[model samples]
Target: MKDIFTNLYNKVIGFFQAEKGDSSKVIASNRLKLVLMHDRTNLDTLTMQKMREQLIKVISRYIEIDQEALDLNLEGEGDAIALMLNIPVIRARTLEEIEAIEKAEEEELAQKAAKDAEEQEDAEGSSDESEETEKNTKDSDESGNAEESVISEEEANTEENLQNEETNETEKQKVKKK
Candidate 1:
């Protein structure tokens, strides 16, 4: 009766839906494109301006740049979008200056890598110490503080199963007594 009509309606809807593909998927794809466009263009005017200013400052330091003639814009070329930077340089930088800048950048990167490696080592050492402490506690609990005893996976599983059975038996006995 009602069930037959509902089933027919569902079948018809599913057939049409399968034929046309999912409308929600199309809507989601459109929404994602819009969000990506917004992100690519730096939708926040303040952030965009700040980033442009930062770029100008950094570029000016390397060469004699004409700030007023600089162009920073997002351009669409076919399916891809690119952030194009057109900076007019007042004068060409000397080779010595360029080499100095490269050397400084390399030094900075090397220092940063060393610092990162030291931090990683410190993190790993601390984690290892904590893991050792945890292992000590677990070993002490299992061996009753006698010594570190290595048990096989099968033995550990069997011990766990036996403990569970004992607990179940105790619960059943208490229930019976009650």
Candidate 2:
């Protein structure tokens, strides 16, 4: 395309126009190469910038780095693309410190899991106790109904016996009067 030809022309012109020992020319050429690589790989500028930032953040966690001097680029080698990163490190984290941080995080997660499990168990236990209490109440209600029925039957029998005794007494009085 016309754009490709223009880019090639610019690169050639820029190379010839560079003075000896000019670092700016090298920087410009590297930037152009990065642009070309991004175009070929279907990667946009924003995505490349975000990737750079994330890489810096992750690497900085283990080492103190000179952020201003970091360089990241993608280069083509035979049909493959390789990512190159150059970072100036100030200091690296000691193994003991990293291990301690990891141990603390793991302990915190374990404590959280234990708390969640305890809450679940408590919920289940309370529900089970409520069910048992309800069952006991139902059983007591059924037994009370049975006891009430038995008491009513005993009262009915006593009333019948009293009526029979009164009728006998009335007949005996009639016999004595006759």
Candidate 3:
């Protein structure tokens, strides 16, 4: 009982002696509030951290910011929750600079598309050349076969004429003998 009383007296004295701007107390209160908000919104710490990072990245695209001084928090009363963002901007990008960036991106895409189209055309051209070569080879083979058949027919006719001349000479010899 005496120890409990002594502890209570010490705590009271410490509270009175505490500094007016104690940062630790403020930090603890903020943490508690954040936890409660997260619970109420069905959100987790990892999700909140990811949101913060994405927000910073998107905001940085339009303006130069002091990332270290940025503050992001969730504040609400009852069922109405609101996101509070305090971002410090050094400077904003000019419209011309943004337009130039977009133009460069478009040009790069156009160049890539043109290169792809050229490659496709080259591939089709090679295939077409191969097909033409095959056609020429087939035509030559057909012509060669036709020429060979014509030569064989001419040889056959010449042999028939030679046989007829030999028969005539034999008949003349027999008549002379008789």
Candidate 4:
């Protein structure tokens, strides 16, 4: 009797619910795509366009450049930037110009490395003690039979010591990178 009434209630509730697509959901998906593109190239939309202009100016300084044929596009799918620089056939640049370009690339890489290091430091400081304990508890719970599955105090202390050693090594590496 209870099952029949519950089924009828569920059917009645389902009948009047309308299915609809939300505008915010679409906008959010578009925003994510745009932001990811910006993040992968490390340049926002305006900056990327400006970079194209600057690159044209630099190339024109060295040789006759066709602005219409130049294509400087940065598109990235996953963790890699696809830089497309399609300029008309021109004479090779001088040694000095090549060195200048190399320096620009190295500086960009250094900026990315610094940004990553700062983000890592921020993340390390954000995880609360309760969250860490809960993770350990969940890990232990997932490993074996409940009857014999208890972390010993000594085992916990050893793990903590190991973590400390790893932390020290990480700090040393960070200092060296500076």
- Model 2 per-residue lDDT at 72: 68
What's model 3's lDDT at 108? 86
Taking all chains together, each candidate's TM-score versus the true structure is: 0.35, 0.40, 0.45, 0.29
lDDT of 4 at 147: 29
Clash pairs (backbone) in predicted model 1:
none
Model 4: ten consecutive residues of lowest lDDT: 145-154
Candidate 1: tens digits of C-alpha lDDT, residues 1-178: 9999999999998888777754676869766765676587666534545566789767865797876556666656557987778886899678888778778878999999999898677768786776677679887785652232223333444754776688889999999999
Candidates, ranked, TM-score: 3, 2, 1, 4
Model 2 lDDT per residue over 82-152, tens place: 88887878889888866766677789899999998986777687867766776899999978866765664
lDDT of each: 0.70, 0.75, 0.75, 0.67
Model 4 lDDT per residue over 42-128, tens place: 686446555766897677656666565565555566666677787875676687877777688789899999998986787677778
Q: Highest TM-score, which number?
A: 3
lDDT (Cα) of model 3: 0.75
Q: Who is ahead in TM-score, 1 or 3?
A: 3
